[model samples]
Target: MANRGRLFWKILLGFWLIFLLTTQLLWAVFTLYNPRHEAPEDNIARRIGNVQIGTAGAVLARGGLQALEELKASWPPDERKFFSDSPVVDAPPQGEGALPSMQQTRGAVSRLVMAPDGQRYLLRYDLDGLRNEYHQGRRSSILHMPPPLFWLGLTGGLLFSLLLAWNLTRPMLQLRRAFERVSRGDLSVRLFPVMRRRHDEITDVAKDFDSMAERLQVLVSDREALLHDVSHELRSPLARLQLAIGLAHQNPKNVYASLDRIEHEAGRLDRMIGELLALSRAEHQGALGEDYFDLLGLVEAVVNDARYEAQVPGVDIQLTAHQPEDYTVKGNAEMMRRGVENIVRNALRFSAHGQSVFVSLSRVDSLLEITVADQGPGVEESKLSSIFDPFVRVNGPLNGKGYGLGLAITRKVVLAHGGQVEAFNGPGGGLAIRLRLPHWE
Candidate 1:
């Protein structure tokens, strides 16, 4: 959580700095491309001074010093200061030493003028004072931005960055917390409901998380149920073995019968343990060996082996192949054989005397399907789905011979091979079990 906070701040600052720097760079480029021209106040002062000096020079030249003085005296005090004139009593120097065209004195423009009677005077206009007045009234430049607008933009960028960062990190933070809860064995945690409105990649991730959690919950529940069933199954056999031992101790004359009963119970326990181990191995897909084998050959072998068992009940077992070609499948041969044998033997167990069990192998689309069906009492419609569960059995004369792990092992082995197994009541009134595996081309 602390790390997420750091990430949020990093994103906010990164975006804000990028925006600010880009804005400043553009401003610099604009300033460089359009350089400022001469100030308006300076231009105005220069033009006004030229006009004033020209007017004063004309008055002195036509009206002499007395007339010029009278003109100055008639003007307002403020206006008189700008049009002062001084007499030039000295004669003009030789051609090369004549007065310069005009002289620019400090803060003033001075011009030499001669009257028609040969009288000369110097006319002057104060330009520096005029420039100062204009400068005081001028406004600031348009090229540069003001402080208030700059601060407003900065604040806006910060807020936008913060909002973007929060939107991104908030979902990530929720995912992290949900993962933490799952790690602590809280499989009920879900994310899609809270995040579905986003409609983005994060929402997809939330949906995936919810699926994973649900799968884990189911697996854990199944494991606990299996454990409970195993313990219950073991308790019944152990109780029977103990009763046989007590009877043998009380009656020494029937010790041989007690010993035979003990041996039978022991064998049953061994068979049950072996089936449990097979179920566990099937459940772990990684432990199986990979190989390619013929589905028709495997089904034929299972049907032949069940024939010997079927003879006891006078049940007939038949095998049929829909296609001439032997369908090939890829997986552990031994596990596949065991899975097929379990389904065939289960069918034989349910079958009555004079009944027949049908085993068929065929190709359906891209899959190899093996179906084992019995001509006996079928399972209840509602309980058909759970027939493959461990320790689940339908009441029958031979039900005691099984620990109810055969169908469960078959289901696990088929699943491990990326196949499917299902049970349904046959149309003619018996149970049918179908196994489908991917066909190896």
Candidate 2:
């Protein structure tokens, strides 16, 4: 919560500071570009001062110095201070010099004017005094901005920044809370519904969070179910072992038979424990070290082993390859071999005498495809999906022959290697299992 508050304040202050800086920058630019700050002689006040001096010079040229003096005396005090003249000893030069022209001197302007009788007068006007009087009459500065407008803009910026910060932090706070709940084992929590209306990156993050929570929930549920199944499976073998010992104690004559039964149960327990370990290892992707090997070789090895087992049941195991290319795959070689062997052995187990179990390897696009099909009764359509689940066995003549962990282990291995496995009934009659693994370049 404190972090959220800090983030909110940071965003708010950042935007507000940017707004303030922008406004001040505009003010500075306006001050630098203002026309009043240009050359003094070209300013409006200087232009007005020149016009007054010209009027005085025009009067001196046409009506002589006495007439200009009379005109100045009749004017107001503020206007009279701007006009003054002195007589020149020599007559003004001809042409450009004879014309009335002004020169600037210490906050004032002086012009040489010629009377009709060749008498020259130097007329002067106070530019500083004119500019001062103009400013005093206006009673305002150009740089002075209205306080109400400044305060209104500042307040508007504050509100806008506050709104923007709140909108960003509100969703973050919600996601933080959702993460906290998930950490506390609350996987049922969902974020997409509440944030879906936003339709932004935040919504996409919420969607990913929801998916993570759902996957964790499924993993936890499956772990619990597997634990229960393991306990039940172990209990049966343990009970049988205890019963065999009790029988041996009661009947000494059949002690050898009881010992044989105990040995068989112990072997079965060992096999179950080994397969359980293999299944657990298969589920962990990290433990499956990356090692590239020929997938076709692995399939051939599994088929060769299954053929020996098939001889007793009078079942034929055939291996075929279609358009074989580089069937290299990257994963733990032992795990891959075990996964393929389980699928083939399962096919051979269900096949009757004089039946054939077909095993094929081929390359499809960027994937290596291996399929095992058996000429035996296939699994029910409803139970096809569950056949790869741990301890889930379809009811058949060989249902109790072995613990149902082979297909489950095979699925975990395939998934860990970024592959897929699926079981479906064959078109003719039997079960067909397919495995597809990414082909390494």
Candidate 3:
């Protein structure tokens, strides 16, 4: 149909025409390979000679030698255009003297047969009639193709080409429809069900489309949830600021207390705003200045700062290295430091007093693996997987710490650097977070 795309028709008609031409070409080749029919003149001549022989033999069988002689004379000499003008040479029969004498002569375009009854008889035929008869027979042979096979081949080819074209374009059509739906904000549209298990480049493309759609759905959903949480978070600070301003207006003489509260709320708002910006940057911003930096030294610096901070609870921060070599990595040193510091500080916040928060760095192949484990109460196993999500937290002493952006930022920064982060409950009754980064060789 005309509604089919150009590619569809191109494939359909192209294959259909090609197959038809190929069938005709093969037939011609085979026809040529076999011997051709006898020439028209030879066929006509042989047929005429046989008819004359049969007529003469029948005359002899029914009416004896006299009948054949009269019949031979009856065919007029003028009708024998294939006859030669040469006179016949008299000769005796070669064998069987009891039989009548026989004579035969070969001419350039005609043949003469003397009757066996000792008579010089010649059977003749019109050359034009012979030619017309031969042409008629030849036409019959030429038109004698089997109808069933002819129709079957043509019909089968049409069906085969149609099926092939349909198979080739069906996936593309499905993909086009899926893309149309997705562009209209239907992120749930998927191409996998339409693919139907065919394993080809087209199927591969469908799989990739499905993956893209699924990722888009997750991204849209997450962005919506993050927006809701942000609105809720901003309302609290704005309300506190408004209330502080109203209190200051109520008691002008005692405005210092309200001023301090306003300043505290303002500072809170500033930190939250700064953290929000960092989270956004982690998700969408490029690398924080590419440089090769020593990861072990960064860990030690973060540990020293955390140790000073941890002194209030007497929590210990321990660092261990499995290898003595420098763990050089390529990324923004500041981003990696912040990510590692967040994990360690979060661990320290929940760690029981006098308990150690262990930090270990090791190399496996081309990867630098950093694991931070604390002796604090770990999160629920079900919530462990989603702890890195924005604004997600479990019931713990550190639940309200830092608006829950620390781990999320850590995940984003690590992912941007082509690394991975995972969290799980440690065997020794605390939480453990691991970071795997590609080491610069």
Candidates' TM-scores? 0.76, 0.76, 0.74
Q: Judged by lDDT, which candidate is best?
A: 2
Worst 10 residues of 1 by lDDT: 91-100
For candidate 2, the TM-score is: 0.76
Comparison by TM-score, 1 against 3, better one: 1
lDDT of 1 by residue, 282-377 (tens): 999888777889888878877888898788889999998986775888889999999999988888888899999998888889988888899888
lDDT (Cα, tens digit) per residue for candidate 3, span 1-441: 667788899888888887766765666566567685545575656666556655655465456567755775787764343432222467544343232322333222333344445443333434445565445544444224334445555777788789999999878788888989999999988777767588778888888998999999998998999999988988887898889889888889658988888898888788888888888887764645678999999999999999999999899999999767769998788888988999999988887878999999999899999999998889899999988987776764253546777899899889977899999988878999999999888
Query: Candidate 1: where are CA atoms >4 Å away?
Result: 1-4, 30-149, 249-255, 324-326, 396-399
RMSD (Å) of each candidate, 1 decimal: 6.3, 6.4, 7.6
Ranking by lDDT: 2, 1, 3
Q: lDDT (CA) for every model shown? A: 0.83, 0.86, 0.76
